[model samples]
Target: MRKGLFFLCLVLYAFSVTLTVFVQHIGIQDRLLKIVCTLGILLSFFAVLAMLFLAFSLKGGVESLEQKENPAEKIPSKEKYLEFAARSGLSRRETEIGWLVLNGLSNIQLAETLYISLATVKKHLTHIYEKTETSGRKEFAEKVMAFGF
Candidate 1:
């Protein structure tokens, strides 16, 4: 949500800046238009700057929320897990499911969490094991845990 707001602020800033510049160009020959355009440009510039400040102020809160939700630090060596998962050609979806499995979610639970069928979850697990060179769920979980994610 914070990210969405930050992006929205950025988009508004870009749009305001662009509109102000375009208006200024169009008002080059009209005194009244020039005055309005100049005011608008100044207002937009300040608004954008203010929004940028707000966005920066909100960043730390967003980061802390992200850390609280995922706690990658607690998980352990997340960068290495990502590298290993990438090299193994595990799709993004597979990696997410693997994380759930490592956290000890049942197939039904995984299905509910992922909004997929149990069979689909099972299928993904099969591919996960094959890609990770593990024989079963237990081994896969052990491997991921070893990586700390």
Candidate 2:
């Protein structure tokens, strides 16, 4: 897979180079050189990015293999994550709201689910986002997923 991805990137780079040269040789005057250069630069940049991606994927594979060889070296227990979340100033109510938010509930839906007023549900969500240092629902969801909750 890695080699296939590498070859794809190389082909893209070659195509970009060919396009650039073709434009220069064709002598078209209407900003064609600028367009070709832009394309070439973008292709080269993406080629480098693809290479970095391949390196990281290979490194991750190696690390997973090493972990299989020595599982005892893994980090602390799962409870440690919950403890960390608590220490990070997220209240139990906020955590509940986070879970509801992750479940695709709007403030009205959340209010109906929890038997609360819509205004109160919004208030709780505001507090939850504030405590979690998240600005929006998507970011809050990401944090919840990060905590594996």
- TM-score, per-candidate, Cα-based: 0.46, 0.41
Q: Rate the local accuracy (lDDT) of all candidates.
A: 0.76, 0.72
Question: How would you encode candidate 2's per-residue C-alpha lDDT over 1-149 as one tens digit per residue?
Answer: 88788778878877887877777777777686778677897887898789778878978988987776442222223364356458668677666666656656688888888898988888888887787788998887666566653
Worst 10 residues of 2 by lDDT: 69-78
Q: Which stretches of candidate 1 lie over 4 Å from their true place?
A: 1-75, 146-149
Tell me how many clashing residue pairs each candidate has.
Answer: 1, 0
Best by TM-score: 1
lDDT for model 2, please: 0.72
Candidate 1 weakest lDDT stretch, 10 residues: 69-78
User: Model 1, range 1-149, lDDT digits (tens) per residue?
Assistant: 66676677677667767766887766566777677667767767776777777777788777876766543433546576777688788999998887777666799999999999999999999999999999998777667667654
What is the overall TM-score of model 2 with all chains considered together? 0.41
Candidate whose lDDT is highest: 1
